[model samples]
Target: MTLYEVTGREMYLKQAADLANLCATWVVSFPYLLPPETPLARLGANLTGAVWASTQNKHGAPGFCTQSGDALFKLFRTTGRAEYAELLRDVIHAHAEGIQPNGKITERLTYCDADSRGSRGDGGKTGWNETNGALMALEIPGIYIRTDRSGMFVFDHVEASIVRQDRRKMVLKITNPTRFDATVTILAEDARKAARPLGENAHLHWKEKVMVKAGQSIFHTIQK
Candidate 1:
């Protein structure tokens, strides 16, 4: 079920209004759950083992051994969920500990030797699950740390960072992480002074909204 529906059901089941309020708080606290197309649901969903037994030998689809970790890490970072972040770390660590000198996770989940012991059907070495395990393990942590700390509410086709935030003074370092050049708008609250680009001499008249281009980075400071 979608998170909104699930939360709504929970709200209906709650006998007390205070408990219902807690559900609302949870929604605000974890925005990642609002997306219906979350990574875990996208990358990890699968049919029973019978559909994948020809290769994976276990229930669920193959080719996602370590990808799930990346999915979960993104979710954790987006939502600031401690449990999901920790689970992402645990999954990555398990793969790391099982990696051989050649950098492949040990085939057997229960295998304790230093050698890689798992089997990956006939798909060869370039399959999705082959090298992505290590790559995802290496890439997820840094992204997690950066995204978790960012307070900016990024919308579609945008990436941003809150360089500094205060009641009277706000500093933002906004970026368009996408490839194509496009216009993007940023919102500021109680901005009283003209917005100025940091590390440069450019400045805009005091405005609550700022627009930037794709792949552009701007440092802005405004007074409340």
Candidate 2:
């Protein structure tokens, strides 16, 4: 088993990419909950593990590991891919349950520790915080776990604002580059259909119901 020594500064994408690449090298490093032929899924799992490693400490809760989760959430927002969200959820749940009776996040579940237990937490030589990292990782998944309903968090990147916001109404000016009518579903999470959970292939599409000029951008509204 390979262990991840993480500091707080590095974000989730860096951690995910590193872990995913590591998973490519070591197949047995973490749990293989992902299916085959899925590079993204594999990377998601490895990223989760990296988050777990950064948070686990001698106390068994977490030291300082938050960026990995952020990275996963960023992926979820940018790609609108539920697989990343789901993987992050699984990782959060595992740690939430894996803590020891004394609230220690030891390696009983996985052999990631290198047996270098000392000033854990912010005081350790590695200077990593796995606990905080693990805890916050679930925020994104928890917010967006519901596809039919409003996700916990929503982001509008086109506005050049990285800030989080509750978009009561959103207009996606979608332009159809091809000719003819293109039939598709615009996956705007409407709380009216709470039962509709977003699966792996959920994407928002813009189509013209009435007269639509070719290569014109359409508008879509969403309330979270």
Candidate 3:
């Protein structure tokens, strides 16, 4: 998508979209029922969006290993495809399921019996998990709405709503229930803005950041 934006080339956009769709297939589309008394099952994890590591590994995991899948969101915006957005949402939400309160996660969120199947091995946090979780929170918008009122999408583990709105502006109320402080990205654009090709690192210019302390609420007002 960035290539397409930079060079005004249709090929790059098509290639990006195709690659994104392929990546979507690696994400689990349905929940798996784990054996009773397992750590994951005891926590009531759904595992609907766990990502498969690779054919060689034969195991599923919380999110992408090294990076957050924010490209999926950019693809959705550029292509206007709802499925891409939904895919990213599922992955991020599922990633949260494996996280412990101290910001640690085991890489073993799988049903394969290769290494004690249902157990989250050794109870250690991988560097990739920590990096990806932070990347997802910082890069993807917690709540996004088209300024023309065409659509709305939420991707974070937070609560948000348009508390008030008028012809000139809209007020959004966002609440974070987690114990950790959250910096949420908010992107609101009209049809014209959405239709334009995004430049490299364009998100920095188009997004608004709101810092909500843990277990607190914040209101952001956007001009239409």
Best by lDDT: 3
Per-residue accuracy of model 1 over 1-224 as CA lDDT, tens digit each:
12322354444333323333332222112111212343222332211111121233322222234443344433333334465544344343333323334644323332111322122212223344556564553344321112222333443234556677565666766676656463433433221211111111111321244456667877766554
Per-residue lDDT tens digits of candidate 2, residues 1-224? 01111322336445655554442232222453434334323233232332333334412222124333444444455445565555455444444333333444443233234343221222222213344433453223222323343343322111111123344543334345534343323333444443232323132222322223455545544344
List the candidate 3 regions with Cα displacement exceeding 4 Å. Answer: 175-181, 199-207, 211-219
Model 1 RMSD in angstroms? 15.7
By TM-score: ranked, best first: 3, 2, 1
Angstrom error of the Cα, residue 133, model 3: value is: 1.3
TM-scores for all predictions: 0.31, 0.33, 0.85
RMSD of each: 15.7, 17.8, 2.5
Q: Which stretches of candidate 1 lie over 4 Å from their true place?
A: 1-68, 111-129, 134-139, 146-224
Selected candidate, larger TM-score, 2 vs 3? 3
TM-score winner between 1 and 3, please give it: 3
Q: What total of clashing residue pairs does each candidate reach?
A: 2, 17, 0
